[model samples]
Target: MPGPVPAPPAAGPREVLALAVPALGALVVEPLFLLTDTAIVGALGTESLAGLGVASAVLSTLVGLFVVLAYGTTASVARRLGAGELRRALAVGVDGCWLALGTGLVVAVVGALATPTVVAAFGVADGVAAEARTYLAVSMAGVPAMLLVLAATGVLRGLQDTRTPLVVAAVGFTWNAVLSLVLVHGPGPLPALGIAGSAWGTVVAQSTMALWLVVLVVRGARRHDAPLRPHGAGVLAAARGGVPLLLRTVTLRGALLATVAVAATTGAPSLAAHQVVFTCWTFGAFALDALAIAAQALTGRSLGAGDAEGTRATTRLMVRWGVGGGAVLGGLVAAASPVLPWLFSDSADVRAGITAGLLVVGATAPLAGYVFVLDGVLIGAGDGAYLARAGVLALLAYAPLLAVVPLAGLRGTVGLVLLWVAFAGGYMAARAVTLGLRARSDGWLVLGAG
Candidate 1:
């Protein structure tokens, strides 16, 4: 009898799990950190909640603006790894570190000057104004630490070293939790600073994580010349290479800030409640985002290894995994929504608002997860222009909805976010489909195998 046809190559569960393992804790801890911040501050009073929400919004907009370094660094590193140019990748990574630090310093100075104005623009009460300014000031102090960790971690992720970042994040969160309890509540010798203490605690936590990354990358370089270090020539070229990603992030930031503005304009209660729901939703997104990071690094490195087949297999498998993960988390969140609000706030209205919005977030989890994974694959392939266009399209779709927010109420604001997820997912899916077709035409991919 003739032998059976050979089975097609595909990524095993083990491989996918290995790639996605690093982001697992961050998926849990980051959202937990946000909740901790909200809970700790909310205990102080409603003004504290209002202040923290506005401050967090400003911080998100600021950080969101510079995500280019991350998107670019990952793809750049992945491309170099694919080309077997480890040294070049390290050089670009180092340059990115310096760029982020310098930019962060400028932001620190400017952010300090702009705090009052930004808080004012939010239109919060005089009673909450002091709390907002205090939160913003403390959070701004942590910018350098936060930027360092993000930039350095992005470079290492390109090299597929997710473990180190995970360790750093764990350490950061541990310090954050400990410091928050001691400082915010005035336990031991620490004076109780309330909401301000939570803000300061964040800075300290981020600093610890940033230092951890520095130590890891430095030690890695000392051992055998890590490609993530700076080099002479790629400095200028590397910065330029990050531009498209920067543009993509800038456009995306605009969308996010606009959303926050819409929510804020509705009233303080809407902002506070949004701050809570968005924080929970992010936990799910970031958890699944680890898969995207895995997919991006795998695709880039696989391509570098001259295994186009490997890249296609990895991307397809990752997308499926991401969607599945999202669905599971959404279900869990929906089921747990009954008890989640008690952890964040005691206000009946705020609790009800957060619970109501989470239902919508839960329903759309799978589609949103696809968007997150596709973004990772594209970023890994250095396709920021494509991402930028999609974001612009999504924003355009959202513009008209802005007028409808007041009428539809708080739930309407959350619904718009769901729509944003749909547009984003569609954009990424189109790109992935295009890439798959091209890979087939080039004879690097086999359809029947999948």
Candidate 2:
């Protein structure tokens, strides 16, 4: 029929920016939930703060699985759209929302049931155990909303509409911020709900964003005129796309879990210091990954449009943007070292640990940026196998590194993770090269957009 139903439209700068804005906005606002949780809990006591750190680390393994679905969904959708199947694209968005809700609901049930066990497993002080359980249960209630929101964003990515997701994320975060303040402090006649309030705020805000996305999809307002609906096909497609990605995610998540475990072995104050720096590290890492997100969306759309050339050009620009962003962020961290940790802790040891760790994290910005962008390109190209392999290797190295390295010191510990990030980037670059050589196709180098 009609030359395979015509390639998807080429992506220009306007389309790229349109996608990037929302992606950035969503990413920035999402973390504020953690900030809100931390702030509210901190007022309760340091024990609560430490408990959150441990519990979150524990829950991270499960969160990693949900992230796999969200990240993988877009790649499959983009591929279908590239093949001139707008209807398929819509299915992914709809199906992803369903997947999010389903996954979140399961997490809520599991978390509530297991909160006591999980909290106890973290080995927090007996006095703090009850508080940790409360926070865990309440936060778990919002897991479904987080999952739905993530899934919605994934759909938007597939459609090359990152900006919409970003706006939605901003709205979600704003809702969380306001709700958290009200529920936590009990403004006016409101009774303070402490950590429970923070959790409620997160749920309400996330639900708001999830609903907004559903509305958008139902309105049939896709840039490509794709109709949206959630179904099994999208779910299966995402699962297939994300399965290999899961390997990489698990390995990476395992590495983080190992890092936390190792940090715990050091001491509570050290673990506390590491956790605070980690939140900061997360902000920087996400900012860097934003470039990768942009790369993934642009590359997928390019491939969809059959413009291999566009894909290559977009990759180059994203690399620049990623590196530039990393440099700026690293510089800011280094320049403001004195004041940054004050927000987390005032202990001399904690501050020293944080300052030293952040400096190391800052210096690795360039390397981290490169790794993050390559990760984007690979994912967009449906090449998760190699990245997963690299993660496996990295994790293997990490276990031994922690065993031998006196991770007792914060600088020493943070530096190791930074090194791992560099190593990760290098491995992916090699894989990309291998893909180019084996494929021996212009699509590997200078082909048109999909």
Candidate 3:
């Protein structure tokens, strides 16, 4: 029989920062990639920019669904490691990598095959639809690589190491930016591939990152005597573990896409403005997300070691950090609200819409901070089932408000502002409540049981 689980050292602010800061750097790299693409693609023309927007939306949704690769692996591996089962923890990561590869290939194939139909659903203009199809098709080719990166990043985070992923992400982002600039503009003898160039650049960067991560995981496994080969049962278990997270991710993505659909109806300027604000919102989330990542890692470790009080202490610290960090970020975002939009677009209408939306996003940052951290805490505890159900409920609660935006004749800047207010404010509020309730209860304290 197994002996009593040992208590882990209590994590304080310093420990939280150690995990969170690097994770923040890694998380910021992702949105920066999108922002780079947006800026470069915007130079192609409004239609091209719009097409890129549509294509990104599709790609984000697809990739978001596979976030389970990271989250699930982190929780499971952390728990095992916390329980002094280092080999088991590493094995969990290995299985997650295999599952990520399999699922990613399927998504890539299906997404590539259905590119036209998928892009067409956005009801873009002919020129925009064509460009979107081109970008989406090429981008789908990199889905497998991206998923591999996600799983590998998860493995590292679970092992209580975020610095390596941060370094890898920095290298990948730099390569992507340089390659994209060269390919998009076609310097010297190279031909400008336009939007296709941008797509291909991203694919190459993703492939590089994936390969590097594979090397790192292999090296670590060898060093620790962990098996690198995929075990069928273990892989299946990892896939199964991701199911609830998959469902939760789908609902979250659905809410986002649904909001975009509403923005599309408001007109091109509104859509463009929504994109800018959304990107900034995503950027702002990095700090909060960093805190959440800390919570996940710390909570999981505490639980694995059967240190329930340590887990509670970690949660309280993270919550304070989240709220405080959010307030500061919100202030910065608001201060830059006037100038940030100009970086993405020159359209006065778009800029106006973005400014209005940023105000709402800034005002609600505390709510988002709380929501994100609680989410991480629950995830660390392996409370995927509750999260899935709560996500669906939150979506349902927000749907009516989003649906009313277009029907209520809200258009242009007003509509754009209202859309964000409804989606971010209302939707996020719902999530905050659910996650907060869960955090306050002891129901989520089942450590190694996951």
Candidate 4:
């Protein structure tokens, strides 16, 4: 046999940047909606701001859990595109959209009906709970639109296009901020709808974005002669494919939740500091994920083209990029840690706690980089089973480290630093070990466009 298909021509910086830059834009823009909502809703009153916080948390959880719609679809569609099965890729992506629609609708119904219960569960004051219920009720209207955006975005990413989603997200963000400002306060003839107006503004903005994406996908389907109607088997398969990734997500989320719980025991100052550091960490994660997203699409495409060596080479390149990117992020955070706390808090104790926590975060950034890239590569390989299993194992590894916090009576700044050490150091290292081992092996490199 001819020498195993020469590693698909070297995947250089150009290839990586093409996908990563737009991905970074889309990823970073996502959180701005919540930030805008907070700003607009804050001006209403304390009760309204509190309610928005609770409601926004619920919405974020819902959307985060369904991210598999994007990741799974990206892997599936990219593989087919790599296989030169353009029509089939489009058809698969359509099925994912259908599945997203069906799932979103059901979630919207259940979420809307349970708004009062969900709000009550948060245990807020009567006024806050009432506001939460109202905001969540209206916000439920946007859940389907949000899911549609996720799935459709995945479809485009799989098609090796990221710029479109970035554009749509930018426009949606602008519209949401403007409409929310006007509707929440009723700038002109429009009646002030209070917190509910903020919800509506977001809903309308999300729906418009969803519509735009659907139209684009529909146009692609038409050009490729792909089926738009939901096929029972195809839709079911998409759902099934997403399940493993869902499990993976759930476990990872569980780990984060556990970390939060541990942080809660360290006193109010520590908790406050932890929150700020965690938020910063999350922002950094979004930046790192941009490279991972590129790795996902490219890895899938390479494997679909049956170029295993190419996939391996490309993965190594991404790993390098991940390390470099992470080191830079870590350096920036370390440099800024002294001043960053002033922006978030004026309390000396809280600032001290944040500074301690951030130092640990800075030290571990390279490890996180290594872990995140392999994660994307595996996800691109559609190796969710291993990822799901590994996620649980990594969680298990971190649990004992976290347990030491309470046992050791770590408190205040000490507690926060210990927590970050366990999190960014212990937990991330566990993830790195599991993901690193998998990447070094050929087990996840299943070639062909199945």
In the range 1-450, model 3's lDDT, one tens digit per residue, is 112242364787778888899999998888788889999888899988999999998887766788789998888877887888777777788888988899889989999999999888889899999999999989988999999999988888877788889999999999999988888989899999999999999999999999998888877677678898999999999887789988998888889879988999998999999988987898788789888888887788789878788888888888888888888888888899999888988899999999999989999998898889999999888899999999999999999989887899788999998899898799999999899999999999886635
- Model 2, 1-450: lDDT tens digits are 012243344555565566666676677776566776777768878776776676666555566667876677676566665666666566666776777777778878988998888888867788677667777787787788777777767766776667777777767767788888888789798899877777678778877887887777655435445445445765676666567788888776776666666666555665677787677778787777777776776666567666666666777676677667778888887787778878888787777767776776677666667667767776777667666766676666556555643433534435444433433334334434443342334433322222
Model 4 whole-model lDDT (C-alpha atoms): 0.91
- List, residue by residue over 1-450, the lDDT tens digit for candidate 1: 001121122456676677588767654665567678888888899998898888887887766677666667776665565566665566666777777777688888899999999899978899788899999988888898788877788788777667777777778887898888777889767689988899989999988888877666555554546555455456666567667667777766666567666677556655677777777776676777788887777666666556667677777787788789889988998898788888988887777767776776777677777777777777777666656665566566556655466556644335444433433344334444544444345332212111
Query: What ranges in model 2 sit over 4 Å off?
Result: 1-18, 41-62, 184-194, 221-230, 263-277, 337-356, 407-450
Positional deviation of residue 254's Cα in model 2 after best superposition, in angstroms: 1.7
Q: Per-prediction count of colliding residue pairs?
A: 4, 18, 0, 0
- lDDT for 217 in candidate 1 is 55
Q: What overall lDDT, based on C-alpha atoms, would model 2 receive against the true structure?
A: 0.67
What does the lDDT read for residue 385 in candidate 3? 94
Best by lDDT: 4
| C-alpha TM-score for every candidate | 0.78, 0.80, 0.88, 0.97
lDDT score, residue 17, model 2? 60
User: Cα lDDT for residue 280, model 3?
Assistant: 87
TM-score of 2: 0.80
The collision pairs in model 4 are: none
Candidate 2, number of clashes: 18
Give RMSD to native, each candidate: 6.9, 5.0, 3.8, 3.3
Error of 4 at 220 (Å): 0.8
Candidate 3 is scored at a TM of: 0.88
In candidate 4, which residue ranges exceed 4 Å CA deviation?
Answer: 1-10
